[model samples]
Target chain A: MFDLEAVSAQWLGFTTEKMTAKYPVEHEPIRRHCQMVGNTNPLYLEPGYVEKTPCPPTAIPIFALPGRLPPDPKPRTTVLDIGLPVMGQGFTNMSREQEYLKPVYVGDHLAMQMRIVKLYQKPTRLDPDSLWIVTEDLITNQDDELVCLVRNTLLNFRTDEEWSATGVTKP
Target chain B: MSRQRYWEMVEVGEGMPEYQLEVTPTLIADQVSGSQDYNLMHHDRAFAQSQGAPDMYLNTGFIEAMLCRLVTDWMGDSGTLKKLGIQMRRFNTFGDKLTIKGKVTHKEMNAGEHLVYCDVWVESDREGVTVPGKATISLPSNQLNH
Candidate 1:
């Protein structure tokens, strides 16, 4: 049986203990990646134009911190592998709410500190045979400035028989 | 820096042009490396299939940045991207073509500041499924007098 209470309690104190990683921003690579991703705006790809703006582009900050979660060892496993009999999963990127405390240069070394901000367990509305577990991760840069906040929601389904055995409503 | 008067003559329903992106393995790899995301599912084809994913790996939060750029690009430099929200509905894999589009949905005047609200989405060309959900943004008032 999954312990909702225990899981919630564990998520409460999740923190980074000197958890850090660095990425070198090769101008060509960053620009090419931006171009390949269809972001060919002058502000991001054209260095001459970006020099005239307050921020190169929000994508620069995003590229500063790119993945779902940081690479670190923790007491609990990542939410991706949490649920059993996994049916399907998805990631809902809530937004990038931040303050550019300092300019992020091309060669700047960006570090991240991540923690589990929230977690919830709810029944799936789409499929009566499943339940959805949502987890939100808060990430910040080395300067203690907010970089990007990511919320990833994963869905898992119990077999139809499992639902019937529990006498749960199909609806 | 000369601030472009983006808000001086803006109108509702007016938006920037659309952009198309092709998802590739190298793109996904660079994103994973930059973000320190070593998840095998995003970079390993065999592992992804073993895990039931249709392809080797898919794009991550970078998609949000792409959509946000689409909005900011239309709004111009003086425009501040206040907020952007996206729900990942479907998976994007290598060889998949995606359409990044945005439209001005609402206009408002608050405390003498002109703001234009826009909605954005990223739809996959193959499945016609929107991989990212509705995004809302706030742009400066082009009507403001310097």
Candidate 2:
């Protein structure tokens, strides 16, 4: 078994030197995001509906959250998977916590930096060798203002071999 | 068009009407294609079954979009979503009845805005509370200028 705790200790507080989106937020991708959800609120799509609001273009739906948005061209994975590669184990998304701090606009250039905030291990009678990886992604807009904070917890299970190798039988 | 809910009209502990969301194959396909999250388990049934999933599961982006719709559908155009969070405990697979539900947990007046906090979840026939999360929204007051 690899030294999971030692490896994780090295990763705590690890953050990327901010990563900027390859492209700015676009209408087509935003439209696709809306259509997928069947959201027809018009604030995001219909210019006329938005015209009735205080700021016509300020009400784009949350689908346009460029702060946490995937790169324009779309890939199998997301830019937010900051710490998954290090664990080398199958994991399931357990929870996500977000705080929207500022308004994100379509033309804003969004960038993200991530940190491994914590590593929690819980040994249960049923799944004693499981652990949770908590990562926080601090997202910012062009002005360097923090627009969103997306924190996620993933339950990573150790394989039988891994459990045997770790020598800690009970989780 | 959906109902336009204002800050004055909503109250703490008020329950937002629940809606049924269907997880279909074509819908999942559109979601994966749109988000570019082509996880094999989300698109390929054979591959999914090999991994012990009964069928193709919905991707995280798709679920997030659906959750956004659930809130925005209630808040209307003037409302701004400050944050939306979700945690998945199980697969939102095809043929499941996704019942989206939410209730206001906390509300406060702050900095010329009405901030509402809610506890939300997407439950399915297969997995109860497959995705449970929280959201914070800033809405324009119906009575006062925000």
Candidate with the greatest DockQ versus the true structure: 2
Write out fnat for all predictions, comma-separated.
Answer: 0.17, 0.46
TM-scores of the candidates are 0.67, 0.80
Model 2 agreement with the true structure over A20-91: per-residue lDDT tens digits: 766665555666667776766666666554333321121222333433344343222232344344332434
Write candidate 1's Cα lDDT for A31-144 as tens digits.
654554555667656777654443433444444544323454321225443332233333223233332334455654455444555554555444543445444444445565
CA deviation > 4 Å runs, candidate 2: A47-87, A123-127, A158-171, B1-3, B49-52
**Interface DockQ of each model:** 0.23, 0.44
TM-score of chain B of each: 0.81, 0.88
Interface RMSD of each: 6.3, 5.5
Docking class of 1: acceptable
Cα lDDT of model 1 by residue, B1-146, tens digit: 22353554566677667887777766776666543445565666665554445775454546665676677667766666655666666667777787888877777766655666666777787777555444444455534444
**iRMS for model 1?**
6.3
Q: Check candidate 1 and list the clashing pairs.
A: B7-B141, B7-B142, B7-B143, B8-B142
Error of 1 at B123 (Å): 1.4
For residue B11, what is the lDDT in candidate 2? Answer: 85
**lDDT for A150 (candidate 1):** 45
